[model samples]
Target: MAKITFIEHNGTEHVVEVANGLTVMEAARDNNVPGIEADCGGACACSTCHVYLHPDWVEKVPAKDAMEEDMLDFAYQPDEVRSRLTCQIKVTDDLDGLIVQLPEKQI
Candidate 1:
């Protein structure tokens, strides 16, 4: 399992242990971490699971795919460099201690 730290726009933190192969959105839903709507259920069809990766992890995570990048256009307060749909981020042993910052909106 890998430890994922989710921080809210207001600075609240929800840290949870997520098993490998699961997406970050799954971790939030399983742990009841607020701000992760996951409206499309990790299909990369929606941006309700938008999050910003910490600078240290930006390059560690894989780059977004065409579909994911397109879907991100619907994300709330999207950031060109930092925005990412949590559903596309699969958990891995190498991603332990991953830090994801939530956006102010998920609608």
Candidate 2:
């Protein structure tokens, strides 16, 4: 399992040990972390699961694909370099201590 930490816009922190192959959005939804609406489930078809990698963790996660980039255009407040769709981030050993911050909103 990989340990993932999620921080809300106002600094609420939720940490969960996620199973391998699960998406980060699944981890948040399973743990009840606020701000990750995940309207499209894990399909990567919506921006409700948008999150920003903590500055310190920006380089740890893999690069976003074209689809994720396109979907991010609808996110609450996207950051070109930091924003990501959690559904696109699958949990793995390499991201054991991954940390992500929720956007101010998820509409």
Model 1, range 77-96, lDDT digits (tens) per residue? 88888888999989999999
Per-model TM values vs. the true structure? 0.97, 0.96
Kindly provide the TM-score of model 1 when superposed on the true structure, using C-alpha atoms.
0.97
Where model 1 places Cα greater than 4 Å from the true spot, the runs are none
Q: How does model 2 fare in lDDT?
A: 0.92
Error of 1 at 22 (Å): 0.4
Instruction: Summarize candidate 2's per-residue lDDT along 1-107 as a digit string, tens digits.
Output: 99999989899899899999999999999998989999898898889999999898888888999999999999988999999999999898999999899988997
Error at 21, model 1, angstroms: 0.6
Range of the 10 consecutive residues with the lowest summed lDDT in candidate 2: 54-63
